[model samples]
Target: MKPYNRRLRILCLLLPMLCLSLLRPVPELRADPSAGASTDDREILQNSLSVVEIDREIERITAQQETIQQELNKLSGQLEDKLLQIQDQQSRAGAVIRSYYMGEREGLLVAVLSAKDLGSLIHMYDVYDMIMEHDRTVLDAYQSEYKEIKNTKLAMEKKTADLEEMKSNLIEQRARVSALQQKVDQGIASSSDPEALKKMIEEFTLYWENVGLNEVKTYFNALASAMNDLPEFIQNQDGAIRTNGTTYNIDIKEDDLNAFLRSKNDLFKQFAFHFGEDEITASGQSGTLSLEVQGHYSVEEQPQNSIMFHVDKLVFNGYELPDTTCRQMEEEFDLGFYPQQIVSFVKATEVKSTDKNLHVTLKLSM
Candidate 1:
């Protein structure tokens, strides 16, 4: 073959090989199929599990401590009762001793000498013996009760000490778990592989999304427990819902509302919804009786992407709240109303209510 022809043939072969190389699949860094986890993933999972266990331990210890405290309180009451009984018994004994020293003995002696018959003297002697025995029995009962009270106090002290020690150990375990979590978080953050970091984020996001609704429900349940009743819709904000022949409306911010539903205070920072001229703000506060969420959002400026809730009626403490101004409500009634729960990201076309149930319509941005 001619030299030019030979060179052309060689180029054709080289080009196909280069294309094949480019089309070939790149090697992936993956977890072992048999092991079912990558080293980093396993580490993260283990750290998470450790944290959960530590939290459980802390809760158990706290419960135990509370029980111990209750026992201590009961012991205190018992001790007080015992002390009162001892005081009463001591007073009776002192009175008895005083009577004997101040002339009761002389009187008894004179009565015995002046008795008209042996039978009368015998009867007087019997009365004297019975009185002495009654005083001795009271003193003995007081001493027995005092001993029992002393023992209970000692047991209470020991229980308190044990509870303190348990709490200390739980604290140490929590610190350890926290340290491990920090390490795991740092490892994930410092990862140089973009793909790995992305996977981690996706996993976390999926986990949170799955549990988000339930968390919101739990938060509401907690709120109800704290407040002793759910408040009227008007006390909360502007939204409309109808149930059991009643319509309800309130004003609320979308983000704050979702945060309430998700039971997460942090979600409030993610979105801003203006309700008229005012932007909505949300904050969480704990009172002695309940958790309080406060904020306001304008209805006119409801963002296109925000969630909206409408309710027809709200029932609290077996009474349906009237649709009235907040100022008009009874002073003693506290509307434990807050923005919570994100039901959907899609808007609904129709809203309805039933006799036994309050129907709520949720609107979500497409």
Candidate 2:
């Protein structure tokens, strides 16, 4: 063979292998069905787990605080009832005293004098002593109940103070956890390489084939068509032909378009393709297209055919797209593709720019 022909054949044989090497799973990407992860990747995962634990702790503390507040409210009501009981007792005592004073000042003496004999006078004196003794017993009971209520109120107030202190401490702890979480997040973000992140995002799309839902399968077919068609439309550069004879231009940078599609592979694995970020610009006669999507696949409890995907950040050309606009586009994409049984879900949360690249963090279900 000619030297030039031999060289060409060797190049052809090696090209596919080179491509395969580029597409093969990296150590960080081997999270599913295997236990191979680098130290940094494991640390990243640990940080994520720690964040979840912290969140759970915060929730538990909050629930406890709510219970304490309810107890305090119940105690307050009891104290009020006790106060009302004391007032009622005082009123009854005052009424009895007033009735006694209102009676004839010499009533007892008169009764004794009018008695038929000494035996009658002694009996009347005994009756008067019994009435005074009954009154004294009622007064003592009222005073004892008042003291008990006061003591109970003091105890309750002390408990409430203690609970308030506990709640304050919990809040401080929550704040500290939140700060740690932020630091971990920043570390992860800073350490991540955009190219690797993009590759991971692309790898995620392969999981769509694992979806068990027939409806989802159909929706994905349509979604794939729509996604693939966008690039074609841009590549054709022949304005989109309208029935009205007007052509709409769609100018898209090919490299950027490929980068955009590659960055969404991981997102597809997570069922969050709708929110994938467009690292390229596909500007046409219509409007610009840019997006950022984040999502995940789970066999756990989740709504069927429902993806919790959010476009947390988006931009079109130099202009930032409003959340509403981003959402509208997402809805339009769904409606335009699978109108019968909607499979994809999207929610736009915010618009922000970051180094003109799509950065995604992989989240694998364990």
Best by lDDT: 1
Candidate 2 residue-wise lDDT, 299-343, digit = tens: 112233222223333432122433333343444444221101211
In the range 200-270, model 1's lDDT, one tens digit per residue, is 54454333334322333344444334333223322354443332222232233344444444443343333
For model 2, what is the alpha-carbon lDDT of residue 310?
36
Q: Candidates' lDDT values, in order?
A: 0.48, 0.47
Say which candidate scores most in TM-score. Answer: 1
lDDT of 2: 0.47
Candidate 2: Cα lDDT at 263: 56
Estimated TM-score for each candidate: 0.39, 0.36
User: Could you tell me the TM-score of candidate 1?
Assistant: 0.39
